[model samples]
Target chain A: MLSKKAQYAFRALAHLVEHYDSGPVLIAEIAKKKRIPLKFLESILLELKKNNILESKKGKGGGYFLKKDPSQTYIATVIRIVDGPISLLPCVSLYFYQRCKNCNEKHCGLHDIMKSVRDATLNILEKRTLKDLI
Target chain B: MLSKKAQYAFRALAHLVEHYDSGPVLIAEIAKKKRIPLKFLESILLELKKNNILESKKGKGGGYFLKKDPSQTYIATVIRIVDGPISLLPCVSLYFYQRCKNCNEKHCGLHDIMKSVRDATLNILEKRTLKDLI
Candidate 1:
């Protein structure tokens, strides 16, 4: 399951994608429109800015905007930043791989099955971007 | 991520699947072999038994065995029993469906992508049975 943080991240970014050319949108507006808590949405957008996925302006008319095109910002990247691995099992994860202590990878059926699950999920997430949501 | 309870449940059932037709196996043996804590394994197996995936023999040589053939037990069933829904988002879930509070299903791209994810996971997990693990 996607964590609440990841879900909020998607909502916030999608809002930015929707208003890309309308100048920086305020945090309060995104919070109100997305139904995300104001404090939490502020933190999420700040993190996205720190990662270069979003950029912020200061002073009058200041707010946040996508630093990269929405199509270039993959959902998989955001999920990874906020939720760790896309894989259900650490052993099968590409970005966050960890060997299972209890089983041999050569023979473990669950590992094989989970790898396929991860692959299927990653395939869609990597292909789709925030633009797709907008 | 799979919950710890679901992981323990899978370990316990896979142990049972391996020992099927060889008589009931002790909980301690499975716990020690699978590196799962004894108390946790006990609860997990009991849940599986209560769901009819397993049965206890009682008395001398008593332990647990698959109540139905391992081939008849699906991983998706166990996951659903423990994890609620296979979908990443509640709106995409079939058995545990709920409308998203923040978005319209007709226009929400995240909803569409997650449906594909849920379908892909369900296809694999429903097709592969406990017998496949053994």
Candidate 2:
């Protein structure tokens, strides 16, 4: 399941996507619109900014905006940026691969099955962009 | 990602599946073979037992075993029993549905996309069983 942080990030991004051409949106506006807490959204947006998925301005009329077009931003990218691995098992993860203890990847049935699950999930998330979300 | 508890449950169940017809297998044997901590495996097995997926025996030559045929035990069932929901979002979940906060389910894009993802994942997990894992 996606964490609350990841879910909030998606909600916040979707709000930004709606205002993609309208310039920056205040964090307070997004929090109010999406029902995300203001303090939680501040950190989430900051993380996105650090990852270059978003940009911000300061002072009067200052707020946040997407760094890239919504069409160019994939759900998979957002998930990875905020929620980490998409795979259920570390051994099956393509982007965050780690050897599972006590199992041989070559012979593990769970590995074989979970790898298929990861591929199926990625097929959707990688193909769907933020533009598709709106 | 699968929780450590869920992963350990799967690993322990896989071990049980391998020794299904050979009478109850010792907990120590499963722990050592699967690299699961003995105490953790005990709780996992007990949970599976409560879920009717496993049963145990006591005294000499006693241990835990699958309550049903491996072929009849779906991976989806195990995951739900141990890990709760399979879908990325609560709104998209079939067995564990919950309305997402501050979102209209009918108009939510994340809900729509995650529903597709849930379907794709269930296609694999529901069809695959403990038998396949062996």
Candidate 3:
């Protein structure tokens, strides 16, 4: 359901959530904790900061911190921000719906089956926030 | 939730299921019908047969056939055989239960959330047989 990017992003964010509202969270610390590449994590945090999921400062005593407590940030939100959709197949996806190449959108035989999968996926991913993971 | 190999395997199998009980299913036919590469599908089918989901014969008038109906074969089985586990995270995985690197395996905090996701994914995938997709 999630991509490598989304997985990496969630792992990083969960680390932030663990230290939520206390102080700035360092990119290096998160990268080391999550086994993510430092440069790659730097970019991921920048994107999260852009999306207001995290707030950051560049100087000493300055690092990224959650804009909200981890409990408030849903895993679905992180996934959508990082991966565009919780479902890889657009035909079954709610957040990123698209027609299958050779099928009718309204009466697709695949619609029901795929929808069930999509809903199940969302049900699990949507309920869990960063707090749940940590 | 799905790997590239699983997705491709499912696609190829669905194509085979479509033509079930009709005649011998050519590897090329299933590959082309499903838009999968011929060579990659060859290996996928071989594995499927190794699991007895399919039966094959070499030479002319021989290709492949479902050992049983596509409806009898669960997507979960295919996935497990091909990709080991549906869950990417080891903490909540059903088939491949490895301990998380930083957590106590017995009472891991990540367990419930990951389990829910795993269950949801499995519920959807398990209900879907190749016949459903076809």
Candidate 4:
């Protein structure tokens, strides 16, 4: 399942994508528009900014904006930023691989099936851009 | 992410699938082999039995066994029994559908992508049986 943070991040991004050409949009404006908690959204947007997915301005009429075009950004990147691996099992993860204790990946049935599930999920997430989502 | 309960459930089922024709396997033995906490494995096996994925025999030389042939049991069914919806977004879930708050399913981009994700996951999970995993 997608974490709440990831869901909120997507909603916030969708809002920004809608106002991409309108210059910086305020955090408060985004929180209100997306119905995300202000404080929670503050950290989420800050994280996105730190990751280069978004940028911000300061002072009067200051707010945030996407660093790249929505078409260039992907939902998979947003999910990874908020929620770690997309794989259900750590052993099957490509970006965040971890060996499952007491199990041999080569011979394990669960590992094989999980790898397939991960591949399937990645196919959709990698191909679909934020523009598609927006 | 898969819940701890779901993971343990799979581990337990994998162990049982390994010993499918070897009579009832002890919950204690499964817990020991899979490195799952004994108490946790107890409840997990009980739940699987309740779902008809497993059958338990009490007393001398008794333990647990798969209710159906391992080849007939799918990972998707076990996951649903332990973790509810397979869909990332409740709105896209077939068995556990729920409306996303403040969103219109027909027009939401997240909904579209999440539905694809759910379908992709279901495809691999539903087609692959416990036999495949073992």
Candidate 5:
């Protein structure tokens, strides 16, 4: 399941994608339009900015905008940045792999199945970008 | 991400699948072998039993076993019982569908993408059963 944080991030990103060339969008406007709580959305956008997915301007007409073209922003990238991992098991994760205690991945049935699941999920997430969302 | 509860459930179920038709296996044995905490595994097994995926016997030689054949238990069934929904978005879930607050599902791009994701995930999870785990 997508975390509340990741869901909000997607909602906020979709809004930004819609306003891509129109310039910065106010945080408050996104909050009101997307129904995300203001404080939570602020943190989500800041995290996106820190990860270089977004940038902002200050003063008059100041607001947030995508740092890259929506076509270049893969759904998988955003999900990983906000949600930590795509795999259900840490052992099968491509970017967040970790050895399960007292378990051998080479001989684990769960590992093999989860790896397939991760691959299947990534097949869709990696191919679709924010541009595709629009 | 899979909840710790769901992960433990899979590990326990996989252990049961290995010992299917042999006899009821001790919970303590599964806990030690799977590296699951004993207390946690107890609750998980109880939940699976409640969902009719597992059955337990009491007294000497007592333990838990699969209620149905390993091949009859779909991975998606266990996951949905243990972890709620497979889809990232509530609106896209087939069995656990819920309307997204303040949003129209028909015109939502995230909804469409998530529906695709749900289908891809279900494609793998629904076809594979406990028999395939071993």
Candidate 6:
């Protein structure tokens, strides 16, 4: 259900949680551990850092680490930072909801079905903290 | 989340369900009605037909029809026909799972988390039938 970017981002965040007390994790190391492409992981980390889900450094021992404890980070928060809205349809999205242009009724069957999918997916993503992923 | 192919297929199938008692729906007509690219939808219906979720007619007045009543056609069945598998991670996949290469234990943390996601997503998609989409 997660996007490729979101999957990679969650995996990388997990690695940091597993090693958070040690120090920041190098993007390359996280990529290797997670089996994600180096280039793709780099951009994901940058986005995570930008959103403050993660923080980074630039020195010899520098890399990326969580801005908060693993328990403090929700998987949904990290996912949205990397993949935008998680809802399959833009109109059913909590962050970007706008009724679909062709929806014939306020509770159109199509929209209702999509909304069920969205709500079910979000309930799982939002309840679990990054601590659970680790 | 729905794949692009699954999204197109669902729209096409909904069109078919909407006009089932009528003659076959032209690919172009369904595409236009649903706002999907004609060519992309052509392939989706082909795949759906291969899986027997849909049946097609080759000559004039022939398009596609559900293999069974719309209520018998689960959204999950159509989605699986159009998309390889829905689970995000390979290990948690019901159809293609073979533990992650790096997972240390049978009930490893990562798999457990992904399993929860898969289970939750499947529960919603599997419950809704194509009848709901129509």
TM-scores of the candidates in the order shown: 0.96, 0.97, 0.81, 0.96, 0.94, 0.84
Checking candidate 6 for backbone clashes, the offending pairs are: none
Residue runs of model 6 more than 4 Å from their true location after superposition: A1-5, A25-41, A58-62, A96-99, B105-107
RMSD of each: 1.3, 1.2, 3.2, 1.2, 1.6, 2.9
Between candidates 2 and 5, the DockQ winner: 2
- lDDT of every predicted structure (CA atoms): 0.87, 0.92, 0.76, 0.89, 0.89, 0.78
TM-score of chain B of each: 0.91, 0.95, 0.87, 0.95, 0.95, 0.89
lDDT of 4 by residue, A1-134 (tens): 77788889889888998998999999999899889999999999999999989999999989999899888987788888889888988898888888888678889888898898888998999988888766
* Lowest lDDT block of 10, candidate 6 chain B: B98-107
Q: lDDT tens string, model 2, A40-132? A: 999999999999899999988989999998989899999999999999998999899999777888988888899999999999999999998
lDDT of 2 by residue, B21-60 (tens): 9999998999998888999888889999999999999999
Residue pair clashes in candidate 4 = A1-B1
DockQ leaderboard ranking: 2, 4, 1, 5, 6, 3
Which residue pairs in candidate 1 collide? Answer: none
Q: What is the iRMSD of the candidate numbered 4?
A: 1.2
Backbone clash total for model 3 is 1
Residue-wise C-alpha lDDT for candidate 5, range B35-129, written one tens digit per residue: 99999899899999999999999999899999999999999899999989988888989999889885578788778888888888888899889
> Clash number for every model?
0, 0, 1, 1, 0, 0
Q: Per-residue CA lDDT of candidate 6, range A10-127, in tens?
A: 7787789889899888999998888989999999888888888889889899999888988888877877777677776766889866565655647566668778777877787788
Deviation from native of the Cα of residue A70 in model 4, angstroms = 0.8
DockQ of 5: 0.69
DockQ of each: 0.79, 0.85, 0.39, 0.82, 0.69, 0.50
lDDT of 5: 0.89
Provide interface RMSD per model, one decimal. Answer: 1.1, 0.9, 3.2, 1.2, 1.4, 2.4
Candidate 2 to truth, TM: 0.97
Across B13-103, the per-residue lDDT of candidate 4 in tens digits comes to 8888889899999999999988999998899899989999999899999999999999898889998999888888778999988889968
Q: What is the lDDT of residue B105 in candidate 3?
A: 52
- Output the better candidate (1/5) by DockQ: 1
